[model samples]
Each structure stands twice: as C-alpha cells, then as structure tokens.
Target: MFKTSLDKFTSINRIAVISDSALGFGSPDIIGLADGLCAHFGAKGILVQPDDLNRPLVDINFTADVRSVRLFSDLPTYTRSWRWNFFRLAARAVDEFKPDIVVVVGPNGYGASRALRHRPKLLVYYMLEMATTEPLYADLHKHYGNADIDAYIIPDIERHNIDFGNLHWRKDVDFEGIYLTAPINYPVPIKPRAADDRNGKSIYFGHIHPEETLLDNMLTPQLNDCEIEFFGRIGDADRGVIANRIASTPGKAYRGLQTPEDLADTLPRFNFSLVTWKPEGHIGRFHLPATKLYHSVLAGVPIIAVPNPLNVYFIRKLGIGLLMDGWSRRSFIESIQAAKAMIGSDAYRSMVDRCRVAAEGEFAWSRQVSRCAALVERALEKKWRRLYGPRKSQPALAANG
Candidate 1:
C-alpha cells in the first residue's frame, strides 16, 4: 500500500522549495516538510532562500538528494530593493533547477509570483505563520493572488479558517491542513518518566517574547514548588529582564537554545510542557497547537496549556494534557498544582501512554507527508488535465517550459 501510494509521486521528479527563511538550519517546519517531501516523492529537492547570514551552499540529506541555494548576500542591508533582487535571484534559481513542483514557504508571495514567470508545473504556498493583522492579510492576498499559486498548505484547519477564511481566492485554489508536527526522527516507544523522578519540573521551549508574561508569572513565590525551565531564543532587549527573573527565582532557570535533537532528549526529563500564551490580541486569538504541542507528546510529556481553542480541542481529544481554567497567574499556578498532583498517579501513566500512542500514530510527520504527497499529486493531476488534456500516462514536464 505504501509503495503503491508513492507511485503517483513519481511524476514529480524534482521539487524546489523557496522560503524567506534560511534552509537546512532554519525553521524546523520548513526543514521537516522539505525532508518529508523528498523522502515521499523520491525527488531531487532544491531549497532557495536569501543568504541573510551568507552561509555557504551545502547539501543536507534527509531522505533524498536535497541542496540549498543561498542568494543575495552582497546587497546593501539598507536597500529597499533587496526583496525585488531576492525574487529575481530566486526565480533564476528555480528556472535553472526546472523543478516539477515549487513549494514556497514563509510570506514570500512576490518571490513565488516571480517563480510563476518561469512557469513551474505546480506552485504551492505553504503558510508557516499566521496573518496577524488585516493589513498583512490584505497584502498576502494581493501578492498570492498575483502569484496564482495552485495550492496552500496551512498548519491547522482552525487556523486556516481564522486566517484565510475570508480570502477571496481561497475557493479557487487547493488547500490542505497539515499540522506543524514533530519530525519522525524522535526516538520511538518513548519511555515515560517515573512518577518519583518527575521532580516537579516543567519546560517551555521556542522563541521567548517579553510580551507573553507567563514566564514571569511562573517565577512568583506561589509557584516555587513547581520548577520550570526556559529554552530557545530571546531578543537582546528582553534578555536582561528574563535572565534576572530566572536568577531571582529559585526553581526557574533559563537554559540556552537547544537543537532539535537536544530538545527531544531533554523534554522527557520534565514533568510537563508549558504551551500557554497571553489570551489577547492576534497570538491569543488564533494561536494553533504548534511544534511545542507535538514535541511534548513525542517526548511522552503531558502539556499544561492555556484555553486556546485549538489547544483545548486537541488536549481534550488526545487526553495527553491539561488546560488551565483561565490565562491568569493564579490559573497558571493552579494548573501546575493540578499537574503536580497527577504526576505519580495512574492517570498520569495513562496520559503518558496516550502521548506515546499519539507520537507514533496521528501526530507523526510520516502520516502528514503521505497526506501532503496525495494533495500535491491531486493538484498535479488537475493541472495536467487542465493544461494538456487527460492522458493515459503522466510524463514529467519541464517546469520552466
């Protein structure tokens, strides 16, 4: 069945993934998706992105042959034409690669539009971030429409509706809800931490913004019994504030940024994973259950999250985590206490079992890759028929032709 399913992807011989972010060492989502596509399709994949850091072109194998094209490092930082220059360079790269499919990640609609000028067989816009404001949404709509992207891959269905529901061109294009899940590289049959060994420590990983304020709340004396570790990037301006908070608090500690492998190994040591956000504004309003949620599950750790709709829905459905009653410091403390109580119980064991089950089953990226392949295949078939009429055999076509 697996081999048969992948047979359809043979027509897609080469794929070009263009993104605004760096490749190989950038967003885990981009890297994971690119890897999954390469593995599933057995295609040569080229990742094109701006050389913001001037990194050398390198090949990082995930499953199939994958290479990076770093462009536009010599342009002046203050120049307004960098975006246009990037689009031109990216289009030239896509033309040279002549990939059967082009998957654009990030908010680089104009770049994707330029790639269209080269006439890729299929153009897909993979939206990794939410359109936080109306102006941004309008801008994305304008550029994406101009790009004439064939499909969209949004992280979550709820997020798709919240972010792109009003998009006028949405119905005209194919779209799929692929959750931002953990890569399949995490070790399987996750050993659940013993109740006694949990040690009341929880974890919060990913980019830390001072505006969230939940970390600061966790430092209060009321929550001292429950230790929490912070990981991932922090801006220079907020570093002092967070460092001081961690220093002053007995149980709170700021561990430096962790690689994905390190994170996978480290997450299981904690009692719980924190997935809370301030319940206001764009982030609070439509925040989806992201990498943190799946990472925690894969590590066999239950999530203690705020009552965001997607988080609440998944937590209740999976039975792998708990949701706080509200987004207050008191509610946060209460949730930690609740998690602490369940630490050594059979209930906690059940939750851990659920996490392991989920990690290997629905939440895994392997399944998502299959879904993605099918979506791309469908888009290709439709495009093939529309462009050249129905055919008995679908042959690979030059994307630039």
Candidate 2:
C-alpha cells in the first residue's frame, strides 16, 4: 500500500531504527539509510542496536539530534536471549522516543514490530537478504504475513528474480518498494586515488568464515597470483582452522580487524578487493548486493570474484571487476593471474576510473536514501489520508468574468 510518489512531504519528522542484526557483522545499509534520511529531512534519528564495546565503531553523520539506544550489552552477538530483549527495549524506545516512523532492520525485529503493533507509527522492514532456503524461507514468509508491516524494503530489485518455489509474499505487501542495491558509507570529501595508491595487493575486508565464504583450503594451494591480505576477524570456533590455513598459504596474510576509518584508508592502497563465493555455492540463493564490493568500487579498486549471476551482471556491466572462467583449481589460478596482469597494465587505470564513476553515479547511498525517503513519505501520506480524509484545497476566488 506504499505510494511511489517522489513528491516532498513533511509527514516523517522523527525516525526510530532498530538494527536487530549482530553488532559487528550487521549490514551497515539500514543504519546508513537512516543517517541519510535524518540528514535530508533534518529529522531526529534514534538508533537502537547491540552494544559495540569490542568492535571498532563505524563513523556516520546525522542531521538533527540522534539518541543511540544500545541494548543487550552482555550479549556479544545474536542469541536466543536477544529476541526477548529486543521486544522489551524496542517498546521502551518507541514509547520514550515517540518517533513518527519505526524502521525495523530484519526478520528478527518481528518481536519489536509486535511490541509496537498497536501504535499508529509506520513500520518498515529493511530486509537484508532474500532467502528461499528451508527454515529461513518459512520464517521470512511468516514475517511477511504480518498485517501490521507497512512496507518491505529489499536491498536490490534483481533479487526479485530469485526462485521462491511455492512461497509467495503478501499481495498487498510493497515488494518493488525500495532498492538499496548495494549501499556504502561513502567517505566524506570522497578520497582521491593517486598514481602511487596501487600497492600491488588485493584485499578481503570482511568477517572470516573460510568454510562458508572461501574454497576449502584454496588459500594455500591457490591464491598465488598476487599478495592477498585478509583484514577482518574470525569467529572463535574457526580461528584454529583459519590460522592454519593462513600459515600454510604463501601470499595470504591475515591483517586482523581494522577500524572503519583505518579500513577505508587501507582500501585505497590496494589494487583490487576480493568478493569470493563457492564455485557452485548457495551464495546466489540469498542474492545480496555485497557491501564490500561497493566499498571497494567507491575506493576506486576493482572487485575480483568467481561469477554469481548478480556479480557477473554488475561487474561486467560496470566494467569494475573480472569474473573467473572455470571452477577448477587451474581456472582459479588463471583468473587471479589475469587480475594481477591487468592491475599492472597501464589500461588498468581506465578500469579503476570506471569503478569510481559507477560507484558515485549508480551505487550512491544518497540516491538509495532519497528513494527510501519517498517510500516513507508515501507510507505516511497513506496513513494521513486514512485518518484525516483527502487533503482539502483552498477555494477559488471570484471568477475572471
């Protein structure tokens, strides 16, 4: 029931966002969007998220007053206990903040929605991934069935093509509502790339779960083309495996986790950013727009990856990256070697230039938030009309005659 008008409306004054995802691994898109909306409308933003005591905080800007409600300080990550805490804390936040709109982060925020269902606030779901997998699919479908949900926001419009089997979303639900595509926290004053910025390296700057993200033991036997740096943390359970993998690998180096500021600075020094998934993996099932890919593009570095349909489409279309040909060990080496060769070429600068242009033009966070703002306005306008009839216009003066 969302209006698609991009018309300006002053209905949304204050926004309350609850990032129900884990503290460190959460997608920064929702938070970034909220920041942009607040900046655009000069509205107050109250962000409720898990405590960030351990991880380095991401830098963001808000226009008006922003009150952060850090909850479940004792919980390190997503847990069963978080569900209960989210409901209680979110209800308290809404009641206290008295926001005009409440933006819930993911499917986990269903409890928070339930807490505020009786209220008249606009409820928007910022769905991170589109999964038609077994358990998650069922849970997501059920969540979509919630009658109180005003709008559903997916990261990309391309994700709508994913096979959902027999599962379907609510007919009245807003599906083609808002497309974040790939969101990035574009560095303020946009960093410029210099001739000396290419440090002859490729880097991977995200959570480390080699078992799921990387090929089995490929780090050691493969990844031989260029110096590959790993700049993110691994979970405790996988540390032993990851450490052994790094030790066995020749060119691979674990740089550990760096703060957002440090990471942004470090990214510009690299020639390319890594965006890998299993050759015949389930990564395509979720159909997410990779945040790091956009970050690398904005940093003026090409993305190197084995082709997922979405990745291949964007990478080739944007001319910002390369997709490997085959899935075998030899093919993998050949792909990395090709990337290294291109990175060293004079023509590589052209590719880097295209990346920067594409990022600033197509993948801009401002454009995403503008669309989001329109969606919010339309939702609020719907509510306004429902409660207060059609807006009245002034009567015409005396006729010209």
Best by TM-score: 1
What does candidate 1's lDDT look like per residue over 1-401, in tens digits?
45542344337888888876555433556666776787787888987777654334444445567876677567753244666677777888888888888888755534445545567778887877655344644564655563367788877666556555555445566888777674523212234565456656789887676656366567779988777899876645868777777767887789977655566667789989998667556642446555778777877888998888878888899998999888778898888888878878899888888988887788877777777788898888777667666457778787994
- For candidate 2, the per-residue lDDT at 176 reads 31
**Residue-level lDDT for 126 in candidate 2:** 74
Model 1 is weakest, by summed lDDT over 10 consecutive residues, at 182-191
N/CA/C clash count, model 1: 0
lDDT of 2 by residue, 91-150 (tens): 777768877778877655555666663464578877665444346545655555656767
- TM-scores of the candidates in the order shown: 0.84, 0.83
Runs in model 1 deviating more than 4 A are 1-10, 23-26, 52-61, 72-82, 131-137, 143-147, 165-167, 184-199, 283-285, 390-401
